[model samples]
Target chain A: MDNLFYAMIFIIFLTGFWIMLRQSNLIKKIIGMNIMESAIFLFLVAMGYVKEGSAPIATEANPGLAYVNPLPSALVLTGIVVSVSVTAFALGLTVRLYKHYGTMDVDEITRMRSEEL
Target chain B: MITAHIMPLTILLPLVGAYLILLVGSKHRSFARNFGLLTTGITFAMVCYITYLVSNQGKMAYYLGGWAPPLGIELRADPITAFLLLTFAGVSFFVLLFAYDILPGEINGKVITRYYALYLVLLGSLLGIVLSNDFFNIYVFLEISSIAAAALVAVNGDKLAMEASIKYLVMSTLGSGTVLMGIAGLYMVTGYLSLDFLAGALPQAYASHPLTVLMTLGMLTVGIAVKAALFPLHVWLPDAHGSAPTSSSAILSGLVVKVYIAVLLKLLYRVFPLDFLAALPLQGSLLVMATLGIFIGSIMAIRQRDIKKMLAYSTVAQIGYVFLGIGLFSEKAMLGAVYHVFSHAVMKSMLFLSAGLLIKYSGKRTIADLSGLGRVYPIPMIAFSVGALSMVGVPPLAGFMSKWYLGLGALEANQLLFLLVLLLSSLLNGFYYMPIVIGGFFKKETVEIRQEKIPLGAQISLLVLIAATFFFGLFSNIPISFLTPTVQGIFSAFGGGI
Candidate 1:
């Protein structure tokens, strides 16, 4: 079951990378990047999972039962926040780029930019 | 001692300064510049005190949140950290002064406020970069530094500056992303993110998780090289540094990129096992890149019409000297690289700020406009000549001393090819700089115009830096002597091999 989950996430990562390489639109490329970042976050969270485990919190009952490692989960929260910040910043740049050049295509921006420089 | 709180102050002063500027600077256009300078002045004094402490104590390591190393994030002040901190503060303070004198009122006040905010943030992040003892935390600071730095580059809001800054933003983000992935891989293998943990787990990880360890190391090495602008990955640097506002230009070329290089040095020398590095392909590849960067940067500089662009390109070649020395893999060579790091930081900032002032007053951007500048702005022109001479490695100047040691280090290791590269690059330095100096003095000022005296603050800072350009170069024994024992200490950890 763990292996299957890992495979699914790996597939998602590969697809995201492919889209990132293939996409011409800046927004799509950004989405692809977000997808890849999500996959990595998934991988990190999965590292802390355990079979038949409850949340890694203290309680009076079930003191001896298995629980997930909490550290990687905590780390993933930080990673997720960083991903969100980058995504937002990239979006703002996209808006500005469109306003300046009137296009969302990366190639068009590059072409217009080269002539401008 | 009654007070050891200065360690945290080094980081805090800048943070407060950055935030204070953001808070009050927008409304009071009158107060922003002076407030920023006072904050920077306080930070500079703190840095000087830290240096004083290190010079006496031999080393200072402070743990955050009351946890010791291997668990808590450590901020260690070794000689290198202290050296870099002083450079960052010194350069930023002077650049801010220069900025005050020359900032065109045409540029919006709010934009100028944002510039100070980001500049202080960059300075604080650079301090964090130098002092960090944990791998993942260093990456966190690197992200902050580069993002703020990229934003500062484009703060001018011009088309070219915007393009360059955005390009820098992308490449730098990519590099940080790759480095973070490598850190994740390392964490997965060793269950640790601290440098001490990485060091202890290395033998076990190398034996059991060779593939994981190798991949992590390779990713990180290349990522840092990318950030440091080692030859091939350097395309974004010249553009970003060339097009940014002059003060930003000073910080970018002077210390920001070098701080990244220091991060890489810390990564490779302190964390990665020396034996693994020796067996890897990365060192040889770095040598090739340094060789190329030196020659290519020099050739490109010779062709630059814009004076600042030429200086930016010259930085590419100058930085190549540091990489080459590091690649030599000898203690002397590493020490040489480290020494150049300090000397180059001070000298380059001076050159950039002086160029900035010249461009501001004269509105002339090209090398030819510099023709007969010696007649108009004699003080700044002389300052420029000093910086250019130091760059050309003339005797008794800071540049020559770094080159002399680096050249000797190459020969000490019997790396004659790198030696040849250094020699040729020095010649190339002269090729680019001599023309400007000769022209500044020899060629006649074309137009009859009023000779504007530089603002007092700008004039005073330039004088101090000029005096320093001579002092750090000629005095020789003061700074250089302190560095040797630190190198010896780190070298002993490697069994005194290099």
Candidate 2:
């Protein structure tokens, strides 16, 4: 069951990467990057989880309870911050590209630039 | 005790200098440039200090926040880290000085301060990547440097800079993401993030979970290869490096790409066990691919018309030489790669800075447009010629020495084909470079050109770098000696064999 879950996440990651590489629209490509980041986040969080494990926090009610690993969840928070910053920067670039070329399609932009060259 | 402070200070001082520059620079334009100069200069001094200490003490490691082990982070410096720090600080000081004159014209006056700030931040993050003693911290610093580098590329705010920056950002983010996933995989398997602990734990992890180990190695190497622009994954490099400002072109081509290679070296040498690396077909495959990169990149350079684009393609070829050193996996080869990193950093940055000056003064971007221009701008033209010859592996020059050592390593490893590749690539290097030198100095002028006065800072930095190119070539023993212990340590870890 665990193997299946991990395999599905890997497939999602590959699909997102394919979209990022294949899509012509800059916005969709950024979205694909975000999706890929999301898959990694899911993989990390899943790595931390354990069967029948409770919250990682300490409590008197569950003194002897098995707690899931917490480090990956903490690390994912940093990953999310990095992802958000990259997305914001990419969007800013896209706005500039649109203003300069009047198009969001990457192929069109490349064609326009080469024609100028 | 003072030595313990050196590592943290090296990383933090530039960061503090950046903020101070930001605060002071917004008010006065000239202050920012001086502040940047002062910051990098001091950082270089500190680098010298640490190199002295490391030579005396062997290897130094410091615990951050007064904590130890898997809980608190550490900063460590062996011969490899210290040598690279010295190179990083030295090259950055010169590049920052060069930027003082070039950037104002390339970027708007208002945001010029911000550009200096980003440069320092990038420098600091690069230092962090080199010195950080753990895996996750390396990831954090890698992202910080990548984002700063992208911002520096986009500083011009033009259509080309914007496009290139976005392309760089997307590809690098993908690379860093894969790297993070690899680190996470390692962490999950071993429950450790410290490189020392990971090295100890990895061999056992490989025994129990070979598939995961393989995946981790694949993802990590691929991610780093993308960042380093190794061969086929190098599509983003020419556009980004060519379109960026000259200082940026110099820094990115000369240092940024090389930093990733340094990180990959540390990982391969330190974290991954030798048996695991030998078990996989990774080294041999990289050797073949890198050989192809050497050939393909040179052929591409010969086709380029734009001067900056030609240099960018040449950078791709030079990086192939670095990877070839890594693939050889012998001490001599690794030492040659390290020397190549230093020499190339000096020569390539000199080429870019001088090229930027010519483009500014002569208003020429293509090689044909630059015909007979060397007669007018003697200083920059001479620097360009020196750099070109050194790059072509002329006798008594830096590039020649590196190629010699790499050839020796190929012989040691019994890989004669690579030695042939090295010789052929040098011939290819001359094919592209000689024409430019010949056209610049020998060809008669076709068009009347207005020569602008070169900035003092730009002139001084270019001369210094050109001198360094010759110095490293003639005195190759200095770097070779410095790298010997580090390479020996790596071999000793693998039980001290060829």
Docking class of 2: medium
Indicate the worst ten consecutive residues by lDDT in candidate 1 chain B: B489-498
Each prediction's number of clashing residue pairs: 1, 0
Name the candidate that leads on TM-score. Answer: 2
Write candidate 2's Cα lDDT for B1-498 as tens digits. 656698999899899999998888899989888898999999899989998988887788889998896877988888778888888889889988888877788788888888889999999999999999888888988998999899899987999989999999989988987898899889878889888888889889988898998899889999998999889988899999999989889899999999998888878878886666877899987887788888898999999998999999999999999999988888788888887887888889888888888787767788887778899988888899999999999979898898888899888878998999999999999999888889889998766778677788888898888888888899988878877876887876752211
Q: What is candidate 1's CA lDDT for residue B177?
A: 64
Candidate 2 A-chain TM-score: 0.94
Best by lDDT: 2
Query: lDDT tens digits, residues A7-112, model 2?
Result: 9988988888888889999999999999898989999999999889998888788888888988788888988988888899899999989999999999999999
- What tens-digit string does per-residue lDDT give for candidate 1 at A4-109? 9867876876676676657878788778777866776787788777877999889888787899977678767877776676677667777777788899887887
TM-score of chain A of 1: 0.90
In model 2, the clashing pairs are none
Deviation of model 2 at A12, angstroms: 2.0
Q: Which stretches of candidate 2 lie over 4 Å from their true place?
A: A51-65, B495-498
